[model samples]
Structure formats: C-alpha cells, structure tokens
Target: MTDTPKPWRIKSARTIYNNKWVMLREYETVAPTGADASYGLVHIHNLALGVLPIDDDGHTILIGQQRFPFGRYSWELPEGGGPQELPPLEGAQRELSEEAGLKAAHWLPLIADVHLSNSITDERAFAFIAWGLSADHSFAKDSSEELTVRRVPFAEALKMAVSGEITDGFSLVMLLKADHLLRTGALPPELAKRMLAGS
Candidate 1:
C-alpha cells in the first residue's frame, strides 16, 4: 500500500472494549476507493519491551512459557510490557531482571517503536542488547506466568532465530538485528568479540 494523505477517512469511531492493557475500537471509514468500510483496531496501552541479555561467557538468556493467546509453548528472549508513561529503557531493564533473573551492566538500543501485528493492533515494541550481565536472584516473575528460563550461546540463538525456532516476532527481530549489528561492525569491538566467540 502506498502512503497518502488521508487514504482512509474516518467518519465515526467508537470504543468496543477496553481494559487496563488494551482497548478495542471500531471505526467507520471511507476507503481509498471511496467505499464505506469498517475497521477494528486494538490499541495497546503499554509499550512492549524485549531484551537480549548476553553474559560475559557468550551466552544469552531466553524464557519459555505458554502463551495464553496462542495456547502454545513459546521460546523467546526476555520480554514484557512497560507503562507508556515511563522511559522505554527503564521498562527493558526491569523486564530483563524480572523475567530472566539477570541484569546487564551495559545496554544498546537495537530498535524502537516497532509495530507488531500492525494490521489489527497498534502494539509497539522496543528492543535492546544488554551485555556485561550478572545474576540477580530477586527475579519477580508475574504471578500469572509459569516460566522456564534457558541460557543459550549467542550463535545458537541466532541459529534458532534464522531456523524459525524462536517464533515471537519481537524476539526474532531483536535477535536478527543484534546479529546484523555485530556482523556489520556496528557493535563495540570488545562486546562483539566476546559474543561472537560462541558462534
């Protein structure tokens, strides 16, 4: 689709459902072809956060859990949602610690304002690469979650990502982006050397 000024003109809008985290809205609109259309949009209230925490030993952490929406097990990098009012980095750091039980001494922004499933939802994600990691036993995983954490080599994670083993779009984007940064000399030499050792 081409970007245009007012491709879809909204005639009327109404909220269908809303909760603390998300709100669903219905819109009556005129399409690009001037045809009447109805569009449903899910608005996420929180900014999605994802972190690829790499330890000094060339290992990165992943979390395994049963995704409620999909009703299946998923392996993904440490991820969660953060309040929109706070800085995204704060949320990334918090989720890295809470979900993976580890925190990093260094952080690199991989990407930001990532639109996930934009066709139906306005969910945005921010991803970071965290290195110089150490243990933090104060993990406070959400009570609603039953998570399994796995520490894997950076290379293996890359492989899993490319092989479709890591299916979460947020995690997949972060992993591939990290790999691209590392390979393209975009990362600090010291960090790249250490992480690439596992590949």
Candidate 2:
C-alpha cells in the first residue's frame, strides 16, 4: 500500500556502521507528533529464508547450531539469508538441502516478507512448508556452518514450539502456523493427514 500515509518525515540520514550483513544508519526526522526526533535503523542486506521440511511419516527436520550472537546452542528450522535480488524460494530450498540433506517435490509458501523487529531493524523473513521429501546426498553447506540435523514427529516438533524448546523466531512462527493450517482444513487433505498423523 504505497498510498498508505506515513507521518514520520526524514530530514537527513547517514550511515553509522556498515558490515557485510548489515548497515546502521541514524536518521534525523520529524516525529508523527510533529516533534524533532532521531531514529536508528538497522538495514539488513539480505532476506531471511526459512524452511520447515515434513517427511511422509509426519516427521519434520530441525537443525542444531551454536548462535554467534546469543553464544548458546539453538535448535531451529533450516534457515539462512538470500541475496535480495534472488528469489526467496531458492534460498529456502538451498538451506533445507544443505542443512538437512533433503529435497522436496512440493513446496508451500507459508509466510512472505514478514518484518522482524520492525521497531529498529528492516529485516524481512519468508517461510515455506516443504513435503514429499527425499535424501539428496550431494547437498553442500557453507564452509563456516556446523549444523546437527534431527528428524522428529511433526506433533512433537509443535509441542517443542509450545514448550519454548524451539525459540528461534523464524522456526517458532513457521511451526505454529503449519500446525494451525493443517488442523483447520486449510491445506490439502492428504498432505494435512500425512503431516498430522500422530498429533
């Protein structure tokens, strides 16, 4: 909705920091309330792509890794960043194959360009539900990545999301939404049945 009204007006902007992944800028602006204001914006260089893979047996894959920023081990969907100029689906597919060694015959768009932490950052995310999967032995990962992949029943994965065991924002949202769509007759009957088998 480009016609949507924006009350804040930017007077000036300058980059405060720049890195391979992000750029931080300080903006001189006029607030919605008609007051002088300054805001800091974090501009992400790539689009976040997330994939939740469901196998024929109602099993879903998760990847375990140590998060550099959090300095802790985390379990999450196969996710990574895609260059802004590339299609998000390609990135999602690559992440799934490389991190989980699987490829899907069918992919469903779950979420698209959802902003994360919009208050300060312009990081946008896309998610997909992938099924009809099979192993891809030639899958390759980034040299810097060290991921542990696990396959768990979809029902158990959703339980983990509810129990706070899966805390990654992208994974949490995708898992919960997939469960909702499956149970509510939103997805194809056969696919839903396969993914909800033990739920």
Candidate 2 ranges beyond 4 A from true positions: 1-6, 137-139
- Model 1 per-residue lDDT tens digits across residues 1-199: 7976667899999999999999999999999888999999999999999998888888899899999888889999999999999999999989988988888899989988989898999999998889988877566889999999998999999899989888888988998888889889999987898788868
Name the 10 consecutive residues with the lowest summed lDDT in model 2: 1-10
Cα RMSD for candidate 2?
2.3
Report how far residue 39 has shifted in candidate 2, in Å: 1.0
What global local distance difference test value does model 1 have? 0.90
User: Candidate 2 at residue 139, lDDT?
Assistant: 62
> Per-residue CA lDDT of candidate 2, range 10-95, in tens?
99999999999999999999998789999999999999999988888888888999989989899998899989999999888888
Alpha-carbon error at 50 in model 1, in Å? 0.4
Per-candidate TM-scores read 0.95, 0.94
C-alpha RMSD of each candidate structure in angstroms? 1.8, 2.3
